[model samples]
Target chain A: MDLSRISVVVRMRSARQAIDLGFVMACAWWKPLFLSWLIPSALLYFLLTVLFHHQSWVAIWGVWWFKPLLDRAPIYIAGQALFDVKTSPLQCVKALPQLYKSDCLPWLTWRRLSPSRSYDLPVTVLEKLKGKARQSRLRQLHRENANAAICLTMVCIHLEWLLTLGAVGLALLMIPEEINVASQAWFVPQEGPMLWVQSLLSYFAMAFVAPFYTMAGFALYLSRRIDLEGWDIEIRFRHLAAKQARKPAAGLAAACLICFFAGPSFFDPPVWAAEISAQNKGPKSGSASSRAPEYERVKKQILEILAGDDFHKPVMTQGWRLKKRDAENPNGAALPEWFIRFVEFLEQNNAGPNRIAAWFGRGARVLEFLMWSGLAFLTLYLLLRYREGLEAFARNAAAKKQQGHPPNRLFAPDVRPESLPEDVPTQVRRLWQRGAARPALSLLYRATLSKLMHIGDFVFHEGHTEGECLAIVKQSGEAALCDYTMRLTLLWQALAYGHHAPQSEAVEALLTQWEALFQHGQ
Target chain B: MSRIPLDTQYQVETPEGIDLEAALAGPVVRILAYAIDLILRSIVLTVLMIVLFFAGKTGMGLFLVLSFLLEWFYPVLFEVYAGGQTPGKKAMQIAVVNDDLTPICWSPALVRNLLRAADFFPFFYLGGLICMALGSKFQRLGDLAAGSLVIYREPPKAALSLPNRPPRSPQLSLSLEDQVAVIAFTQRHGQLSRARQQELAEILSDVLPCGSDQAVGHLQGIGIWLLGDRGETTSL
Candidate 1:
């Protein structure tokens, strides 16, 4: 009968819609990699290395990749759950367009027999859908924008730390052992006056150099990573799965190879260390020549000029000592911990702070403090100047956002009005078709439903996550039954709006993703 | 963190659509952030100890007192009581948060400040550094013991003109109330307080085309306007 054919057609339409949603769900898996894998994996790598130093190298290696996986899993699960939570008659409104183009009228425009084909659409339908679509779009835009900004902020934070904090750290690392040697009473005094300057140089070095190099290393790393990861693409792909896959992969290969191989190979002192068996090759040979009076005079002049010693301002370690103060009594009973410990430690280690002691008796602490102050001031001055670039960076960011247009993946989901059930009462069909968009939705609710469901289940009784829920259902029955349950579970996750309200676009995305799930046959 | 040229985004779907490219919290990004922190904190702490230790015991005690006092308020008290950081700690993205996991109050400051000794374990902050380098949340010994998190306090966002949103309408012309609502909505986020978010969200929610997007959309539009020629948007 004609009625039977119409019913069959409607069922087929619904089935197609459900299939399209499956593809959408499959696209959502990337979030787990970012939130769960990358950060946590890196974090765990450091954690295991630092905390469980006793662990064998093999364990450390094994744990390295786990963090990146775990880090993203939460977000992956959470984002997917968002799509799965809300189901309603509204979804039919979204599925209609796809059904129209792909199913009912795949080539309606193409069928214009006459050259003068009027391409008029029903204005009323468009007008009604426009409001919903615009609102839906704006919500999607806001969500995407916020997510992008947070990612960018994290990136910038990393970059800033690398430049500023890392700079200071490397500066400190450059400090030599000689500066701390001054506190020892009976050692390292064999040479002469040159030791005093050497001590000062070492102090400045550790106080300033270490932090600088460390920062440089970090900055270099960040800048490179940013170059390779293409985080922006990954973000877009969350909504546009097929498009992301289609995009050319980012180029991280060179940096990885270099960082892992050549970086340490060329720069690691322990690896590339040349034997100093040849005495003439040592810098010590230049030391003797530099000791000449004329050379000393040149060096002194240079020292005074460079004594812009502003770089020596802050010391690196809290316990990092400048040379210990010399006592008035050469034989003054050493009661102070610094002196006692310095003497004891130096003796045990066969080195002395004694050589630099002569320079310490008078105003050395004041001189050192002043040095640090100058360097700190200079760094501030440079940072202020550098801020001009920051303004430009901000301007560029604004421009980038404004110029950006969403890729095809960002298009509104398949739009269609659902067919009303024939057996239902006329009022029921009318009520179902009459969408209650008038209800004011809360963003707190829109953004939070999945979380609510999760916490709800946890608070109520489900011991596992929504993602795990399907697996559990699947395992609980016969194979064929399990498949059916999982499909339903996936659908339920896609459409169960469960007590919370959501923005229309988010809902559309859920519906689209749900359809993709079935369409992809995953 | 400045934007990196190499970073890319991918669309990831949840059961519902949600963004999760940061889902994995990427490698180089996290390591770089931590390394920067470690280097800065280590440098500052080392420098402080070096200065105080060499200053002589009296000088060291004076330095500690000076550090403690420096944390308090006004004329010289910018970072004390609630924010308890030396200049170095502040710059390094480290702060002394309190027991409730919020920023410390002056009294808690007084207690924790006095208790730095208990936190200082066997040699040269071996314990503290261990806690920071090894803990789940990157807590130091003091932070773990104090139940606080040290988060970065970022600089304020730049000022900007908001978007040219025509108030919801049959009417093209804006009434005074509508204009005021838009202004309040746009200016609120820069305030950086949760109270402000709630307050501002109230004003613009009525005028928005989509009630859900009101608060964020208003601000973003404003951001777009302020951006001028840059046309750059902060991407999600």
Candidate 2:
């Protein structure tokens, strides 16, 4: 309302201002927005009941969760408000089918039901983007105002939940006799109108909070856009341009007067205006038309004052300096013997400028050399200390440059894809049977690495340890293969490093599992 | 669907005559981070309960104390010493910092964590949610009182380079500000959609000899030239 206080630059707003603006916006077009929510909410509730076979809990929770879908209506209303388009509540309701098509369906998907979705709703509802474009747009919007949007949504959600609880509690308190009867039956309401009452109460509560919630989120989205695009400044500039455009003739006339005057003095109005006014009002008997002579007289008098002798005169001053002052203490106190000796020593050993320069010059050179060498040493030390990190960075960059092609090594330089035998399980079993336990285990480990790298498409770098490899495999979603790999890796490490070989029977069992796993992969 | 400025970069001038920018995290991310911590805490509690199940009354006593200590001091301890991040915050790629963009100290961490009690008032962090929603910087009441910020720990992205091609200068010599804007546009080209990229380039179509589509490429070439990359061979 106060456009003057609204700056050309978008400013960070107080929480109160944000919420108040959202509230006002909601209040302005509450009817259509509310109806838009009511229609969908009821429909969603009906569909949930029919789909879930009138399961009371599912219907209640499903409707509550589906409140986010109804958010589109208010978002639509707020967005329309930005362009000064005031659609009636009925009109907004009438356009619900279109709104559902463009906005609601895209967001109602399960994957999109997230805290981040709250922020994404405005973009989806207002922008109507799909696929990659939608993704890029969402990323762009998220990069700027994800925090504010998220916070607004979270707060509104909590408020909605709280209000729903309060509404239920209030309803229960109002019907004390019914509640007592329900309590007698273990606080479970009779499977009839009571359930509907409870459901309606929650629905009403959500309806009450929906507009404010949606408005706040929309406000945050607008605020973020304003900050990024400098909309406030753009609006101000546009307004100024429009004003100038409307009065172009007057502006041109002013420009012409300024060009005609063509003097630095013509630009300054106060000085000439004051002089003219003074002449007109002050001079009754005197001739005001001849004021130039009076001005000349005043200028001459000022020049005379400036040119006087006192103006150019320089004053003498005094201060203490080693060369200027006497050797005696300035305060008339006797100086200490040590201080006098120091002064005498300086006086006695008065080296020539060349000698002093040579002494400082040599020291300076040595100091400079030390500084440079020290810096060089520090650089070398740092390079040595973080060599592994630097090497990894270089390796990653190189890997990125290569693009689609996988790296040469899978786990280690020794565990190359080419090195693994074709019949991995059979060869590993034969080797294990021949009492070559470590070799067989190592072969299986290498085979698993190759499987993960080639089959699972897991990227492996040089420095990754066995544990890291296991974690990566686990994260890659081959749960069965990951379990096999973990067991094999753990056994291999124990036998190789700890020399704690497993029993032959256990090895035989593990071999069968390994063969089964590789066979499954085939 | 413009990019939201999610993180506020609070820049502090260090004594070394350099600026360090800290990107402040918003409340939603913070909530996710808190949820992670809650899960972790529950896991720890569950494991302890199972492990100490045989110890009966003594185990129950220890568990109660541990739970109390964990509920109160887990975040505080981690924030003070774990580079201003709890394990949850670390996983979420966020950290708590002093308002001046310094690593949070012990007192502020303690104060902020302790005031979680106040934030938890009237069931399910309702008070904190309200405060966080209303507060600028997405700070809850505790953060406001503690003079601290929870910030996103984002790695600095490398500046994007133009494709390798012969250098092309702008038709009109751009001013320094315009040059910066052009460079920024090129740098952000990867993030923007093709349509959006063309739309933006069209704004400078008057100065560009090429059409909107070609203007985007030419602008990128100019940006490359600005960055001192003249491609394989320099073009006049």
Using lDDT, give the best candidate's number: 2
What CAPRI class is candidate 1?
A: incorrect
Residue A344 in model 2: shift from native, Å? 29
User: Per-residue lDDT of A207-275 in model 2, one digit per residue for the tens?
Assistant: 777776777666666666654553443344334334435656655444433322332243233333433
Q: C-alpha displacement of B32 in model 1, angstroms?
A: 9.4
TM-score of chain B of each: 0.35, 0.82
TM-score of each: 0.21, 0.46
Top DockQ hit: 2
lDDT of each: 0.36, 0.67
- The worst-scoring run of ten residues by lDDT in candidate 2 chain A lies at A1-10
Q: Is the docking of candidate 2 incorrect, acceptable, medium or high quality?
A: incorrect
